[model samples]
Target: MPISSHLSQSPEGDTFVKIRFLAACTALAAATALTGCSQLAGSADGPQKVTLWLMKGSASEDFITKFTSSFEQEHPDIDLEIKIQEWTGIGEKVNAVLAGKSKESADVIEVGNTQVAQYIETGGLSEVTLEGLRVWGSKDWLKGLSDPGSINGAQYGVPWYAANRVVIYNKDLFDDAGVKPGPKTRQEWISATQKLDKGSQQGIYLAGQNWYVLAGFIWDEGGELAVETGGQWVGTLGDDKGLAGMEFYKQLQALGDGPKDADEETPPQAQVFARGQVAQIIGTPSQAAEIEAANPALKGKLGFFPIPGKTAEKPGAVFTGGSDLIIPDKTPHRARAVEVITALISEKWQTELARTMSYVPNKTTLAHLVEGNDGAATMAVGAAQGRATPPTGRWAELEGKNPIKPYMTAVLTGQDPKQAAKTASDTISKVLSSDR
Candidate 1:
C-alpha cells in the first residue's frame, strides 16, 4: 500500500471532536446505561464511563496512569475504565465478548493488528474509517498496521503502534571475527555470517520453526503465505518464489547452531542469544532487555541493524507485530470510544508513547521521533517494508496447527524443499479454505 501524506485535524476538527465527546456524555447521562458504570465512575453523578480492554504489558502502569490522568483532565465528562487482559487464550475470551456471551463488554478493545481480521469476520467491530481517515491521518498509517485492520475497503481497527524484527548482533563477537556490524544485502550478510561462524561462535541463532521470520524472507522473494482469489483464500507456500525463500533460509540456517526441530520458544531464543556465543538473532528490540537480564555482562555490548534484504537499497521485509484499537459493535459508547482513540493516536501522544515504550509510532512520518534510539530506529527502518500475516479470519487457525514449522524442520533436516513446501501449502489451503 502506498503511503499518502499524513493529514492532521484542522481547527474545525478540534471543535468536532469536543462536540462528539459532549454528545456522547449527554447520551450516557440520559440512558444511565449499566449499573456497573456507576461503580466504575465512583458515583451515580460521576463522569460518563467508557470501558476499555487493554492487554497486559502493552503499557506500563506509570504510562497508563499518566495518560489516564491527562485524558480525564482534558475530558472531564468521561471516566476511562481500563481493564487489563492477558494473552493466554485471548482469542476465545474476545470471541465470547464479541458473541455477547460475557456479562460485560468493553467499549474499546486493543487487539493484535493481525488479529483484527478474525474479529472483523465475527461482524462485531464498528466501522471507524470516518474517524480513522478523516479525523486522524490514517492515510499515512503504517501499512503493516493499517492493512490488516481494513478488508474489502472497510476499516474497523485504528492503527496504534507497531514493532518489527531487526538483527540484534553481538558487537564483541563481530569484532572478534573482523566483521562489520551492518550487511546491506543478503549475500553480504551470508558472507559476514560465514566469517563469524567460526569455532565456539554461531553466526546467528535462528530457530528452524520461526515461521514469522520465514514470512519476511518469503515476502522478500515476492511470495505470500496465502492470498485472496475471487473471494476465497489460497495458500501459496509451494510456489517457486516461496521455495527460493526457503532456499535462503536453509543456506542461512547452516551458519547457526539452532535446533532444527524446535521453535524459538522451546528454549527461548533470547536466553540462547544471551549465552554470548551467538552473533545475531532476528527479534524485536524489546527482547534486548530479556537478553541483558539473562546475562548482565553483555549490557552495552549489543548492536542492532535492520535485517538485510536481497538488495542494499532497502531493508528486508518483516512481519509487523503490534496492537490496534477497535470498538466493539455492542458498545453504546461508540462516540466516546472514537474520541479516546483519537487522543491516543494524536501526534503528541504518539511521540510520547513511542519514546516511553521504544515503539514505532503508527505513522511513517513519526519515525523521526524514535530516530535517537538505536533499536527502535533500526526497527523503524524495517517497519517501512513490514507486512502482516495472511489477512484471513482463519489465519489464526492456520497458526494454531501450523504445518509450516514441521515443514521447515523437514526441509532443514534434508527433505526436498519442493516436496516439503507442497505438503505445508496443502495443509494451509485446507485450513484457510475451511468455513468452520
Candidate 2:
C-alpha cells in the first residue's frame, strides 16, 4: 500500500486488506478474459510471457497500463502479463503457486515485507542478492524493508516501498498548551507532553496494547522481541533493556486516559482524537483523514512529526510495515522476470511510484521525491532505522492472541514489570519453537 494509505494498528487493518483483495478478484478475472490468456512459457522462437502478481490497490490501473506499455516498448521480445491478487489467502495462494500446485502461477509476486521469512522457509523464492547489490545498490535500501527479505546472508525478497508510524498531533491543542511542534529527543517529547496533559485534555491517545509503538521504544533501548541463539528463537522481552523501554512506555501512558487493557482499535483512537481532547497520537499520517471525517472542524488542525528517539541525531526505530517483491523459484522465465523487476524498482520508476502514490521510496536517497508531502517526508526520516518483526513464519500466529499485549496491560495496571515480561517472553519462546 502507499505510505499515505491507512492500515490500522490492530487486526482491523488485516480485515480491510482482505476485503480489498477479494473484491478485485472478479474485476481482474473479467479483464484477463477479455484480453485472452497469454502462454506461460511460450516457445523458444516466440516472445516470452512473464506473469506478475501484484496486490490490488498497490498501484492504480493507469500506472499499470503506462508501465506495461513502456516495458513492452523497451523489450519487444518479452510480453508482460499483470495479474491483480488479493491479500485475503495470499499466503496459501503464493505457496500453491511456488509449489506448482496451482494452475495459475506468476514469475514475480508482491508479498508483505514481514512475510518474506515464511515464504523463504518454503524453499520457493529465488535468491537475488547479486542483482540487488550490483545492479540496484542494495546497500542504499531502507533497513526495515531490506533486513526482513535477507536471511543469514542470502536475500530472497527485494525491497520495495515502505510505510511506518509517526507522531500525529493536533495543532490547536499544542498551541493552547503553549508547547512547540517538534521535540528533538525522547526526554524533550515527554516533557512537552507533560505540559499538554491538562484537565480533560490528554497528552497523547496511546492505548496500552499498542505494541507496534512499543516495538520502536524497545528497539531504541537496544532490545529485541525475540532473538536466535545457537539455532533457536528465544524471547527476550524480560531483558534489562526491554524492561527499561516498558518503563518509558508506562511513563508516557500515564499522561493519557487511554484504556490499559485495550488496543487503539477497541474504540478507534482516531475517533477519540477527533473528539478534540487529545494533543497527539502515534499513528500513520493517513489517519488524519479519518479524524477529519469524524469531525470536519479539525481538518487543517493536524500536523505530523517523526517519532522521537533517545538522542537528537535520528528518529526512533519503527516497525517498517510495507510490501516486498519476490520471484518464485519454479518460474520458467527467470531471466526475463529479473529484467522486469529491475525496471520496476529502478530510480525512474521508483520516483514515479513515490510521487504518484505519496509513498516512501524503496531507498532513502529517493525520499526527496516526496518531500513536498508532509506525511511521506516525516515517515522517511525514520525509514532508515525501521525494523520488522521476528523473521519467522510462526510470527504471524503470535499476532492473534499476542502475549505481548497482556504483558503490556499488566505492567500498565501496576503488576510487576519483570514478572509480567517473563511470562510473556516464555510464551513467545514456546510459540516460536512450535511446528504446528
Candidate 3:
C-alpha cells in the first residue's frame, strides 16, 4: 500500500497530519526513554557527551579538535560534539536562543571579553564564582584577564586568550629618518612624528575608526570614558584629562602623521607600513602574525614597543580585548563543561594555544612559554606590563555613535585641533547620555 493512500484511508485523511502525529509520537517516546536513562546516569560515566559551540571556520576548528582529542584520551568515556557558528550577527542569534525561542544549541560557548559582561548581565552565562575557582585548582589563573569578565563580584567567563595593542614601527623607515632607537617620551613622540614626516612617507598611521587605539591614549592621560555616578552613566570625555588625550590624537592628525580616511581598514595599515609608506602604527601584537601572512619580507624590519605617552612614567594604555570561554546557564552537563574549561586553561594547554595563535595566555607562567620565537614573547611581556582600559558593557554601541573618530578624521584632513576636540567632546557627551 502506498503511504499516502494508506493514511487517507485511515482515521486521518490528511497525509500531513498523519506524518505530524507519527513525529509527535516518536518525540514523546524518545523523551520518555531519555528521562528514564537520565535517572540511571551518574558520575561513574559509561558515556558522556559535551557539545561546544565555537565561532565558525578554521580558526576554532583545529584548536577544538586538538583540545578535544586530548581530553577524550584522558577520559575515554567522554565524547565531544563541536558545533561551529558564524560570528556575524551572533549577538542576535544568542538573544534568540536565550529567549527560549530556539532549542539549547550550545553547552559551552566562546564569547569575546567585551561581550562577556553584557552576556552575564542578561543572564545568558552561568555564574562561575570563587567557589567554582576552587574546582579549577587555584584562584591564580590570569586574574587580570578573567576579572574583567566579572560583574558585581561574580565571574561569568574564563579567559581563553587575550591580545593587546603595541607600537609597531618600521625600523628601516625610522633609521632612514635618523630617529634614534629608544623609548620616546610624550613630548619626544610628538617631535619624532614631526621629524619622520618627510615628503614621501608619513610618520605615523592611526586607524581612523579604531577606538581601541584611541582608548590607549585616553587611559595614559587618566581620562575616564564613562563613570558610574549614583547609578547613572555620566560623560567625562569633555574633562581636562580627556581633552588632553584628544589633543594628542588631534596633534597627530594635524601633523599628517596618521592614515587617511580611506585607509581605515586594518590590513592597509600593515600594507602601508610594509611598503614603507608609513613609519609607525599602533596595533596588537597579533599583527605580527598578520604581517607574516601578508608580507613576510617585512618581518625582521619591524620594531615593537609598548606605546609611548605624555609622561615616561605612564606608558600609553592598550585596550585588552580577547576571547573567553563561558558555560551557558542552560547547559546540560555543567560539571563536565567546567572541567573541560579548566583543562583548556591549564599550563600545558595554555602554552600550546598561545604558541599556535600568537595570543597572550591567561596564565602568567605561559608568558615566557613562547620565548625565542620572533618577538611574540617580548610582545606578551609588554602587554602584561601595560595598563588595561576599563571595559564597559555598552562599549560596542557607544563606539559606533561617538564623534571621536570623526573628529579625528577632520583633524587629519586639516581641521583645527581645538575645533576638532570641541566637536569630539560634544559628540562624546551625547553618546554618554544616550547610554544612560
Candidate 4:
C-alpha cells in the first residue's frame, strides 16, 4: 500500500471519470447488459460491512447466494456487501477506486490475475504474506498459476479461478477432414485445419489482434513478450525464438478466414463460430456456453481438445484468463476482508466454483472436478503449463494498448515476419522505457 493514509482525489477526478463513463455508456451497456449492481444487507450496528467487487459470471448469483449465506454463518460480525461489476472498463474503474476517487471503498475486490501485478506495483493492493494465506490452504494454488499475484518474494492476491483457452471444434467438420478426435502435434493441427477448410466454410478464426492468443504461440516457441534484466525492462520480440513463434503464427493465418484485421471482441470468435461456418476456435470454456446461447443447434456438434505445443509430448501454453482476490489497503476491515478471501478459496467454494461455473479451480488437486468434462480436461493441462507476462505495472499498458497488434497485422498482411518483429521490438522497447 502507499505510505500516505489515502490517495487523494479531487472532485474533478470523479467528474472526469463520469464524463468518460457517460461517453462510453452506450457501448458499455451493450456489452454488459447482463451485469447490474447488488448488495447484501447486515444489521446496522452489529457487524462491519465489507464490500466486495466481483465481475459478473454465469453462476455469479449462485456463488454469491451460497457464499454469502455460509460466510455470514461463519463470521457473524462481518457482513458482506457484494457489488458486481462488468469486465468492460473495469480496469479503469478499479484504478479510480484505488486512487480514492470514490468514498465507497470495496473491502475486497476481484482483479484480473494478469492485471494484479500492475496494482501491486502501484500500491493499489495490500501486501499479504504467504503464511497468512496458507492457513486457508490458498498456498496449494496451481503451479505457475499463482505467480501472477506474487512479485519478487511477496504475495498480493489469492488465486481465485482461471479460464484458459482450449480447442473447441465441430465434430462434423473433423469427420469431413478425415482427422482423428484431436491433433497430436503442431504439424498435425495445421494439416487438420487445412483439410477442414472447404467451400464457404473456413478452418478457424484466429483473432490476429488478440495478444493473449498470440502469446501462446510465442510461449510454445520458448519466447516471451519481455524480460527484466539489471533492473530494466527489455522487449524480446526481435529475438530468434520470438521470430520462430511469429512465423508459426503466420503459418496458421493462411489456413483461416475472418476479418484478419479484427479482434476476438469486434467479431466475437464464438458468435462467428455459432454461425456454423467456422470449423474450430481457440476459446475459453465460457464460449462453449455462449455458443449454446447464440445457436443451440451447434451445441452437440462441438468437441473439446487441448492445444498441443510443438509436438504431441508437450501441451501448448494458453493464456490463463481469470481474476484474483485482493484487499485494498485503505479498507477499514482488513481482517474481515481476509476472511472473505479465505472463504472464497476454501475447498468447498473451489469445488462449487468448478461444478457450477466451468472455471478451473485455483488448486491443482481440485482440477479433477473439471477434467470429467472434455473442455475442462484440456484446460486442466493448460493451467499447469500456463504462462503470465512479466510481473510489472508497465505490462498493463502493453496489454491495454496492445502495441503488438499492428505488428501482427503487418505480418498477416504480407510484411516479412522478421521485419515486423524488429518494428514491434522497437515499439515495445520505447513503451517499456517511457514508463521508467
Candidate 5:
C-alpha cells in the first residue's frame, strides 16, 4: 500500500482554507505541493522513480524542483515524485506512515530541526555511519549544521540549511531615545530597552510564549535546559543561571517591554517592530525582509546585531531553524538517494540555495560564496560558532507540555520568576523522563 493510503485521512476541518491562509502569508504550502513530486534524472536504464515527502509551501516546492531539475539534468535516469504535507501536519503524517507496514512510499524526507531529534529517537530515521559521511566530503559540511543530525556519533540526517536569529533594532527609535546603536552585553541590552520604552511604543518587542527565543537568553547566561549529570537528564531551569535569564525576561515584561500574551499562532512581534510600535526585536533573517516590506520608511533606520550575551566573549545563544533532508530507513533507492544528497550538499548547490532562499549553507567553504550577503553570512557564522540547544528525543513533547513561552509570559506578566521557572523545569523533566 502507498504510505498515504495507510495513514489516517486528513481531518474534516477546512484544509483548503487553512492552506490558503498559510499560502497568502508565505507561499510555503504551494511550494510543498509543486516540489513534492519527483522527476527522474539519470539514464533511462536506471531507477525510474524516487518518492519524496516534504513540507507544504511554494518556497520549499520551488527549491526542491529547482534542485531536482539540476540533478536530473546531470543524471537523467531517475524520476522523482513529491508528496507535500503542511508543516503543522507533517509530524503526525510521518508518524502515521512510519507506524504502518507500508514504508516503501517514503524514500526521501524533510524534517525540521526540532523534529529531527525526536524522529531519530523513535527509529524513524535511517542510520548513516561516519563512513557514509565520506560520500559528501567533510570539508563541504558546516560543523554546527551537521551536529543536530548526529546521535551518539552516528549521522542520520544531512543538513539542508540553517537559520539563526538576530536582534533587529529600529535605529530611529534608538536615536530618538539616545540609546546606543548596538548592545554588546546583557546589561547594555537591558539599558537600551529601558531607554527605548515610550508610552505607545515598547523598548523591546518579545513574543511572550516563544521559548525558543527565551532559550537564547538562558544559554547566553551559560545555562542548560537539561544537564546530563551522571548519565541522567536532570532539570536545570531552576538553577542560578536559568533563574537569572528568566528574571531578565521578567524585568522586561514588568516594564511593558513585551507582549502580555503571545504565541506562535498569534503574536505579531515582527509586525509590531515594523510599525515602530517597538524599538528592538529578536527574529530570523527573513524578518528583516518582512520589516522592510512592511515599512519601507524604516529601511535605512533598521539596524541588525547578534543577540547579546552575558559578556563580550560569550556569544548569545540563537535558536537555529531550517530544513534537512533524510533518507528513510527502508528506502529502495538508497544509493540513488545518497547520490542525490551528496550532490545537494555540494558547494555548488549550497551556494545556489543560499542565494535564492537566504538560507545559511551547510558547507564551511561555501561560507564565502555569500560574500556580499552579509546578513546571511553572519547568521551562518554565528551558528557555526554558537552552541545548539539540547538534543533530546522528547524535545517536542517537553516543549508542548512546558510551553517555555508561557512560562516567560507569566514571569513578564508579574508572576514569580523563580516559581514559573521551577514549574517549567519540573514539567520538562517529567516529559523527558517519561519515554526515551
Candidate 6:
C-alpha cells in the first residue's frame, strides 16, 4: 500500500483495506481480465510481458496510466502488465503463487515493508542487492525502507514511497487550550495533552493495540523490536531497556484516548479526530486528505509536526511504514523487470508520486518537494529518524500471528509493563526462531 494507505481507517472505524481487497478467486479473475497475465508457462515468441501486482490505488491512477505509457514507449519489445492486488491477504496470495516457482506470480510485486523479510526468507523474491539499488537512487534511498528490503546479507526488495508518523493537532483546539502547535520537548507534549483533556475535547489519541506504534515507542527509548547475534534472533523487549520503553508507552496511553477495544486495527485516527472529539493524533500525512474529504471544515484547523524527541532539535524516532517493490525470484525477464523498477523510482516519478500522494520519497534528496507543506514536511523529518521493525524473516508472523498487540493492550489497560514485555518477548523469541 501507499505508506500505510492500505491500513487506512474509515470514519466508522472500519478497515478500509478490507473493503478494497477482493476474495482471492475474484481478484485473480479480475486481474486476468485486466492484464492477461500468464501462469508462467513459457516465453512468448514476440513481446514479452512482465506482470506487476499491486494494490488497487497504491499510486494515483493518473501516475500509473502515464508512467505505463511512457515505459512502453521506451521499451517497445516488452509489455508491462499491472495486476492490481488487494491489501487484504496479498501476502498469502503472493505466498501461494511463489510456492512452486512457476511463471504465474507477478514479475514485480509491491510488498509491505513488514512482509518483505518473510518473502525474502522463503526464497520467493529475487535478491535485490545494494549494488543493484544504485540504478534506483541508492545513495539517496531512505534507510528505513531499504534496510527492510534485505534479510541476512542480500536485498530482495527496493524502497518504494514511505510514510512516518507525525503529530497532527487541531490548531484551534491547541490555541484554545493555551498550548502551541509543536511542543518541542516531552514535558511540553505531556502538558499539552493534559490541557487538551480538560474541556469537551479528548487529548492525543494513540491506538493502544497498533504494534507499528509500539515499535516507534521502542525506537524512541533506544530499544529495538529484536536483535540478531551469532546466527540467532532474540527478543530484546524483556530486558531493562525494553521494559523502560514499554513503561513510557504506558504513560503516553494515560494521556491519550483511542479505540483500544478495536484490537490491532485501531479506529481510523483521522476520522475519530475529525469529529472534533480528539485534540491530537500521531498519524500519517495521508490522513489529512481523508479528513478534508469527509469534513472540509478541518482543512486549516488541522496542523502537523514531527513528534519531538526528549530535546527540541530532534524529531522522535518512528517506525518507517511504507511499500516496497520486489521481483519474484522466478521472473523470466529479470533485466527488463529491473528497468521498470528503476523507472518507477526515478526522480521524475518519485517527485510526482510524493506530491500527488503526500508520501515521503524513497530518496532523502527529494525532501525539497515537500518543503513548505506542513504535513509533508513533518513526514520528511520523521523519515530521517525512522527505523525498521526488525530484520528477521519471520517478522511478519511475529507481528500478525503472535500476541504482541494483546500484550501491549494489556499493559495499556493496567497490566504491569515488565510482565507484558516479558510475555510478548517470549512469543517473539519463539516466532523468530521457528524457521531456524
Give TM per candidate. 0.89, 0.89, 0.79, 0.84, 0.80, 0.84
Q: What order do candidates take by lDDT, descending?
A: 2, 1, 6, 4, 5, 3
lDDT of 6 by residue, 225-329 (tens): 778867777788877767766776667767766655454235667778778777887778777777778789887788888877767778777888788888876
Candidate 1 lDDT, tens digit per residue, 263-301?
A: 877788899999999999988877888899999999999
Predicted structure with the largest lDDT when compared to the true one: 2
For each candidate, C-alpha RMSD in Å? 7.8, 7.4, 11.7, 10.3, 8.9, 8.1
State the C-alpha lDDT per candidate.
0.80, 0.81, 0.60, 0.70, 0.64, 0.71
In model 3, the Cα lDDT at residue 183 comes to 63
lDDT of 3 by residue, 96-171 (tens): 5555566546556766666665666566677777424555533554554576578677887787766666777778
Q: Relative to the unseen true structure, what is the C-alpha lDDT of residue 214 in candidate 4, on a scale of 0 to 100?
A: 76
lDDT of 5: 0.64
Per-residue lDDT tens digits of candidate 4, residues 178-266? Answer: 87867878898888888888788888878777666678889898888888778777888878888788888878766777666877776
What's the TM for model 4? 0.84
Give per-residue lDDT, candidate 3, residue 397. Answer: 65
The alpha-carbon lDDT assigned to residue 2 of candidate 2 equals: 29
lDDT of 5 at 409: 74
Report residue 252 deviation for candidate 3 (angstroms): 3.3
